[model samples]
Target: MIIKTPTSHTFVTGSSEGYTPLNAFDGALLAAGIGNTNLVKMSSIVPPGTREVPITELVLPPGALVPVAYAAMESDIPGSMICAAVAAAWPTDPAKPGLIMEYHAHGHREDAESVVRRMAEEGMRKRGWEVKTLKSMAIDHRVEKIGAAFAAVVLWDL
Candidate 1:
């Protein structure tokens, strides 16, 4: 018997404001173009030789169980800021699995993205892998009443 693995991945980011924290999170997920599906949170590893795609190119059945590594932030204080980011670091050797890093905080998009990027780099370095490519996405939200920011690296089987 053979075991199949995810063949492709994508990065997505989104932000939204709502009357409640849960609603804000839902809005963020919708904005990220993944609101309807069930998300299966996975650990931080990109399969060896996985291809990268845009989120718009992903066509999964409605309510399908999707695997993802994600970061999310929510704020209820009016005018407070939140940011979320996710990064992927692929190794120079395509046969080696890569790393995924997620970060969320009360900050700006740049800060959040930078942090996750560094995290990805550090993770690859620790594993003695030279990074071949780095990809990241981030979102920032300013809370009116309740707001959320979300970022993810979604994976799927071919």
Candidate 2:
């Protein structure tokens, strides 16, 4: 499912049998009516290829963190630092504050490592996270057919 500002687009390619008439709009209306959605619920589903993954599969436990990692954009393009932007709730002493969460995207752009470094520094020094760690190594996939692929990190913190 690809969700734009207001409309959500879903794509389905069934086996030779073809797909049934599934209406994403109707489903969205139902979801809205049921009061099951919030602002971030807009892009609630996984991207095209990651559908089979389980929701709890990538969760990082408290006191644990993922490292910096990279994926090949296809060998021609240079690699970039990537951040797994996440909304997190810091554990409060009494939970009195409830869930204090914030939205942040981390990582360095392919050509701008300095910018990434600065952002990382800011996040670590002032972003309220209890921990920060480089999660994964970089991989360059600069194949011609893939075009000039942007530097990106695929895995995410949910």
Task: Summing lDDT over every window of 10 consecutive residues in candidate 2, give the lowest-scoring window.
Answer: 12-21
Write down the lDDT of every candidate, Cα atoms only.
0.90, 0.24
Local accuracy of candidate 2 as per-residue lDDT tens digits, 1-158: 32232111221110010021123222322322211222123222222222222222434343332221221121122232222122212222322111111121223333233333344445444645343232111212222221221222222333
Q: Candidate 1: misplaced stretches above 4 Å?
A: 1-4
lDDT of 1 by residue, 1-158 (tens): 12458999988888888878889999999999999989989899988988888888898678988888999999988888899999999999988998999999998999999999999999999999899999888989888999999999998876
> What lDDT score goes with residue 102 in model 1?
99
Angstrom error of the Cα, residue 49, model 2: value is 25
TM-score, per-candidate, Cα-based: 0.95, 0.24
Residue 86's lDDT in candidate 2: 22
Clashes of 1: 0
Best by lDDT: 1
Off by over 4 Å in 2: 1-118, 128-132, 145-158
TM-score of 2: 0.24
